[model samples]
Target: MKKKLSLLVLSLILLLSTSSSIFASPSGFTESELDTIFEKAGTPQELINQMDYYTKLFIVENSGEDFEFSSNSTSLYKFDSTLDTFIEVKETDIQPLGYIPSTDMSLSMYTFNVTVNGVAMKEIYSQFEWLNKPKDFPAGIGKDNLGIALPGGYEIQSGRYACAVQTKLEKNDAWGAASSSRCTNQSPVVNNLYGAVWEFSASQNYLNIYYKGTVKLTARTVSSNPVKRAVSRYSQARENALGNYGVSIGIGAASISYTPKSGSNDTMDADTNW
Candidate 1:
């Protein structure tokens, strides 16, 4: 009887997943309901393994707190875990996500948070979804586009980007990204090569909105500390994220996306095709 109920509950989740409109765990998918289901499946992470890509099952410890998740309408802030705190946060200043990146690197890689009109959010990241990256870039070009190569005695051309094989890439159709020419004002930008859709962490609330802005690239510098390198990298990333990458930021979103521990056999893959 318990097994039958589990299958019935799963069918309902699959049914809800097909809807185009976003919902916060569905109107009546209360914590008690989820707890009952998950108790059968094992851990929350284990439950994710049995589901298809992008299919989310939110779990809540508080049965009466009214936990929810949904995305629609464009706003500076898209979530309110407090049930409705979609307002700017307090006198909080944006700080590095953790200990600042080492001051001895030459590539950009750091994280921080900021508030707009008081709404607090953190910068996600700026990088490719692996599938969109060139299968085999030149030796010096980093797929992440975070490094500035200086091959010995080779001419330092303007910062370069990696490109994938023609046949392997999705065609420049309506699904492909808009032409890079659309933003003549931005530098160090790359087209998604795919349109309307974006790669995101499935565990977070799908805010699905973006902000655009420009960022200046790092001029040639003699700095060797990782701090300087990290700063330049993050600044460019944040700005380009606002401009080209469409950095997704919001409050109440949890890092539910699972990251396997080292040496694990999980072949982490993105949930997109073509």
Candidate 2:
């Protein structure tokens, strides 16, 4: 009887241990792993507070997907010695917008079209050029043109429509300088881009809807630090048939004006997304 009771107690202990191991976390992360992540993210409320605007937007856009963390050969997290913890690395792509400039770094341009609610929204023209002793050329500049088009016969609900354009210069994935422009019905001109004219459809159906603007970034020397220029264009329509809808496109162009040292600029690749 004593031997039988001892066997029963051992089996129960093993069963309980197995159950606890199986129910550690929904993401299949062990308790110790979860503790490390939480420690890096700080308190629960702190982690929530640290979420930025873009992060929230991403969550809303991908609400149907389950969020999980996995470590492997292609894991996004990397150990940081300064913080003594792991940090997630976000990789951005500029392929969706259009062609990326080659290493030769000549002039390149692409046009991207956006459609919302079965209606054509606008066209974005992104261009980058290397100024070889052009009159008063500092280093390089980013030029963008936005052309707005609204299909006829389709009645657009009266709502606010806004467009924003941004250009950023970065070196080694670090931001250097930026310029932006925004236009709306209430404010026809926010920032002027090379004296470009902005036009809107003369129809009452669409209260405030038009996309016309130009954005230019100040040039920076790239003799030592090879940099990349990223141009982003975004348009938003609020209270439309599909509720609030927004479309954004971006492109990145590499600058090779100055010859780079062997293997020194290997990590200067450009990756941009909007």
lDDT of 2 by residue, 1-274 (tens): 9999999999999999997775243335553454444344232444334322222222222221222221111112222448853344445523222222232222211222233454432222222222121111111111112222211221222222222322222221211111133233322232222112121112233222222123212121223433222222212112223322222222213211112121111111221221
Clashing pairs in 2: none
Worst 10-residue lDDT window for candidate 1 reads: 265-274
Best by TM-score: 2
TM-score of each: 0.17, 0.20
lDDT of 1 by residue, 196-255 (tens): 111111111211212111121112222342111111111112112222222231111111
Candidate 1, number of clashes: 15
lDDT of candidate 1 at residue 253, scale 0 to 100: 16
Residue 260 lDDT (model 1):
17
- lDDT for 155 in candidate 2 is 26
